[model samples]
Structure formats: structure tokens, C-alpha cells
Target: MVSKVKIYVSGRGQFAVQVAEALVEARHHVVGVASPRLRDGHSDESQAMSWDRLRAWAYPRNITWTDSSELRAHHIAADVDIILAAHSHAFIGRRTRARARVATIGYHPSLLPLHRGRDAIRWTIRDGDKVTGGTVYHLTEHTDGGPIAAQEHVLVPPGSTAQSLWREHLAPLGIRLLLRVVDDLAGGRRIEVPQDEELATWEPSMDSPPLFKPELIALPGSVSVDSSKWALHGQEGRDHSRPGSTA
Candidate 1:
């Protein structure tokens, strides 16, 4: 039998819950969970698990759960082997990241070096990219700029919406990738791959207006005019986007 690693998770939304549940089911010790309080009573449609549901699940398992606007290093114990950031808005500082025995892993909806910021999915759909995907990488203070551990490409069917793409492809792919990365690490595999800076691209925060305007265009050899547009930063001619791309 393989030894189980101790894990601490930080983030909100269903993705976080899914990671937590998987870790527990795999026999890993879940030390704690740090999540942001749900502002207002509005439920984010993109999230598969609710805060209440997560709390209920954790409490019965005797796990530590914390809900706050920020998750500091003090909130987590020093014995954790890995810190998983799943859809978390707060940045994990160097001090906190150092507490883990291994590196802090983060789940970004878009493939790194492209669509690095928020709303990657919306941008991809708006830009009419033929493919998009997810990545699990080491987290740094520089946003999703850490070295990648794993990535899976997904084809964007014609007329795809941000919600449909996430529900059908990105979310499931992300879960599988995260689990695979954890398994590799636990089995003593060093899988970090540094990203190429020259090919990197990024998007704005979720609060900002979409970086591109949707327009109708005809794909070569196809009679249908698909909705597409040029990205604001002028990083075009590639396949990219995110699961939670809508701000």
C-alpha cells in the first residue's frame, strides 16, 4: 500500500470541494480547508458544490474548516505536505507556501502562458478558438506563472458557451488532472516543467469588461458564420480559454 500525504486546500466553489473529497477518499489526511465566505446570498452557477454542502461534508469527517476573506499562513498547521489552491481568489503568499513540504499546487482553467488571467473561457469562446484546456501547476506570487505539472487539451465545438464548455469539458478535465498530479507526487515523481515566458499571454480581472467584442465570421470551408473576435492584448491565432472565464 502507498503512503498517504497530508493536504490542505484553499479556495471556494465546487472544484475545491471535489479536490477535498477525492483526497479523503484516497486515504490522504485532509488537514484543513480554507474558503472565502460567500458574499451576499447569490450562488455562483459555475460552482458544482455549495459552501453549505462543503461544510456539511467536512464537519462529519472531523476536518478543520475555515471561511474568511483571506487565508493566511497562521490558519494552516505546519505539518501539511501539500497545499492545493482550487478556484481560490486569494494569493498564497511565500510564507504560507513554505509551510508545505512539497510545492503549492494551483488549478488554472486555461493552459498556462496563454489566457493567464480571469475569464479564460469567455475569452476563448468570444475569440472563436477551436481548442481550449486546463492546467495544474506550481503556484507563485506572479499569478498563474508557475511551472506546469500537467495539462489536457479540449476541443471547442462550434457555438459553445462558457457555461457549456466548463460543465462538459474543462471541469472534468481539471479534476482528473489534479488527481493525476497528486498521485504522481505521492509516488515520488518530480513533474515540474517551467513555462516559456516569450509565448505567455494574459487577460484582465473578472471585474473588467470583456477584452474582446463578439463578431460573426465564416470559418474557411464551412458555410456557417461563427461568433468570434480579436483579443484585446492582440495575442491572437491560438487555441486558449478558461473554465471560470466569465468575471
Candidate 2:
């Protein structure tokens, strides 16, 4: 039987919204959302878009929300069962994470230890790796180096671009894995598998110039997904990775 789990979700974009929606659909209590500020229309394109999507979804549903800055400063609810970081750019401070009843977790779209950076999808395409995967891992001080809770692999088909790969495989794959882990946690399963440091790999930031030639890009005026190395769902940072950084 699945117990009602109280959750605090922090992140940006449609991915984060979907995660929140999935949890609620599963009958979980979503205590609050920490998203980028929408009112400050003076932010970057990505932040602005994130705020818009998050605001539109959260407001109508009456989900309590605060800007990421406030989230970093305050204590998370004492009753929160989990803290889920999805495609978030801001870091959820340790004090906040400590309040979760179970654990704080985040999603990354690579077979971690392999692609431990902001732009795993782009790097995977550049490296030409035939197999890559998604991981739902515990949040730690290390970037994407936390112990694994659950992971599943996805194949990179021929002629796969970062955009196609995410749309066709990684995005949905992340949602599936994340929900599965949430279910496991609610069922009293302890699924922490420490990653092997020896096998770990780190790619350069998404800001770096692309090594892959003629990179497939989104058409102008279309909903932008992958631009240069930037991913549609994640933002770049030292303490974070795709779908976003750890809590």
C-alpha cells in the first residue's frame, strides 16, 4: 500500500511542474513549491520561462509557493516527507534538506558517474556513447555524486540529437524513474547505492563550445528545447546537473 507522503518540490520549467502534478495525482501531499521568481521580468530567458510555467500551473491549483531565494533561507516544513529537485537551477540549502522526513532527491538524465555535469544530454551526443541513462539519486554536497536510489538505462539511437534524445527518451525516462523512487520510499524501502568514484566522468559546462558538428537545433520561434549545449529542462551550475541540481 502506498502511504500519503508529504513533499516539498523545488525546481523550474515543465519538468518540475509535471513532477509535482504526478505526485499530487498519486495522492501525495505537496506542501510547497520553490520556483524562480516570475515578477522580476528582468531575468534571463530561461528563468523567465520557468517562472511563467511554474506560476501558471501553481496559482490555479492553490499550491503554496515561494521564490528560490526564500527557500534557501527558510526551514522546510517539519512534516515534509521528501524534497524533490527537478530541473532546478537554485540550490536547496542543507538546512532545508535536513527537514525532510525521508530524504531529499533529484533527477539527472545520464547514467551517472558517467555524465556528471550540467549538460549531460549534449555531452552524451558529443561523446557518441551508445548507451546512456537516468538516475534518481540522494542529494549530497557533491555535484551529481550522491548515492543512487534508482537508475534505468536508455539507448541512444542513430542520428540522435540532444533535443530528440530528451524528447523521445530522457524526459519521460526521468519522470518514470522519479515516480518509481518515490513509490519505493513510501513503501519503506531503503535504496541507497553508493556510486563508484573510479568510474565517474565529468564533462565541460554547457557554455563551452560544441565539439559535435552541425548540431541539430530548434527552429526559430518554436518552443526552444536544446540551444547550443543548454538543455530545455535544466540549467548549468557546479552544484547541480540536469532535470537540475540536487536538493
lDDT of each prediction vs. the true structure? 0.68, 0.72
RMSD of 1: 8.7
Q: How far is candidate 2 from the true structure (C-alpha RMSD, Å)?
A: 9.3
Q: Which regions in candidate 1 have their CA more than 4 angstroms from the true location?
A: 39-53, 206-243
lDDT of 2 by residue, 109-161 (tens): 89887877668888888889999988989987666778999899988999988
Candidate 2 ranges with C-alpha deviation above 4 Å: 39-50, 73-75, 208-239, 243-247
TM values, all candidates: 0.78, 0.80
> Best lDDT goes to which candidate?
2
Model 1: per-residue lDDT, tens digit, 159-205? 78988888788877877887788888887885889987666766555
Worst window of 10 by summed lDDT in candidate 2: 211-220
Assess the local accuracy of residue 31 in candidate 2 as a C-alpha lDDT between 0 and 100: 81
